[model samples]
Target: METIVPNWPAPARVRALSTTRDGGLSQGAFAGLNLGAHVGDEAALVEANRGLLQQAAGIPGRLNWLNQVHGIAVHPVSNEYDGAPEADAACAHEAGLACIVMTADCLPVLLCDRAGTLVAAAHAGWRGLQNGVLEASIKAMGCKPAEILAWLGPAIGPSAFEVGGEVRDAFLAEQAEAVAAFIPSANEGKWLADIYQLARLRLARAGVSAVYGGEHCTFSDRERFYSYRRDGQTGRMASLIWLAE
Candidate 1:
């Protein structure tokens, strides 16, 4: 199974990767490593693909998956947190506990402290970003923002993420500097947004300065990624992080 290992300055024990639409058991639009079970893929095929991911990635423990709602709700992963919780972000301080989130066009932010005592993954669509998912995830880490490192995973790039005026206005209402991240698109009253930069702005506000991995463009990379905007009925890829034992 093909996966994009996040290239960040995390500690050696922090393991994280974003899976691509490659190497799995599903067929058609959900073909090649479609790890999300709720995206309308057959239950059996999704389960089998998840197994393939576990075997290929060699995850140390069961992945703590989330039923993402594109909100800012942050779920803390531990022995007590069993089954998929309805949240957009997850964090874990325990070794071998994998915090996972599935996405296609939404940005996945993976985080860890400098000492590798904590790890987190967040699903940030435009709404989640505006609602402070990254901030909540950072808060859930139970570490000072300055001590945490973050990676902005694959998402719809600025060039491809066109949005209506309300989207731009909503962000600008929160922070005027957000205006810089939006450029007028071909469609009047619409703008192309740089979600990666917007996320960086939010993280910086919360005192997180060390960030990386915002170069991927899911909307443009059809062969490697599954874009919800590009393909209405597409698959979902998993972005996960965990602390090694």
Candidate 2:
């Protein structure tokens, strides 16, 4: 199975990967490498895809899945949680444990400290990002924000992510700096939102200076990734990070 290694200056022991929509057995809308079982894909097929991902990553432990309510909830993951946790982000300091977040077009932000002791993955849709999801994830890591490194995973690019006035106002209401992330669209009362820029602004506000990896465009890249905006019923890809054993 192929995976995208985050292009950041993180430590050697801080292993991280983001999966695309390739190398899986799911058919139709949930084509190659659909790792999310909550997306209506067959249970067996989803399991098979996840198994393939685990083998590729060489992670000995189960991936910590979250319910992803698109809120600011962050949870600490360990082996004790046998099933999915109801949170938007997860952090792990354990060697074998992996913190993972699934997404299609929404932003998946992966975080790790310079020392490689803590790692986290956050599902940052517009709601979550505006509601302090990244901040919460960083806080959950229990490390100073300055020592943390972040990588922005695949999501809907600015050109394709047109939003209504209300969506733009929601972010502006929380942080005035968010206004820079939106560009006026041709449609009246609409704007083209740059999710990567918004994430960078949020991370910067939280004091994380070392951020990278925001070139991926899920909506346009049909061959490499699945996009919920491009296709209504689509599969989900995952962004994962963990400390190496």
lDDT of 2 by residue, 1-245 (tens): 67899999999999999999989999999989999888889999999999999999999988788888898899898889878878999999999889999999999999999988989999999999988999999989998999999999999999999999999999898889999999999998899999999999999989999999999999999999999999999999999999998
Error of 1 at 6 (Å): 1.2
Q: Any runs in candidate 2 off by more than 4 Å, and if so which?
A: none
The clash number for model 1 is 0
Each candidate's number of clashing pairs is 0, 0
Clashing pairs in 2: none
- Positional deviation of 58 in candidate 2, in angstroms? 0.2
Each model's TM-score, in the order given?
0.98, 0.98
Candidate 2 C-alpha error for residue 230, in Å: 0.8
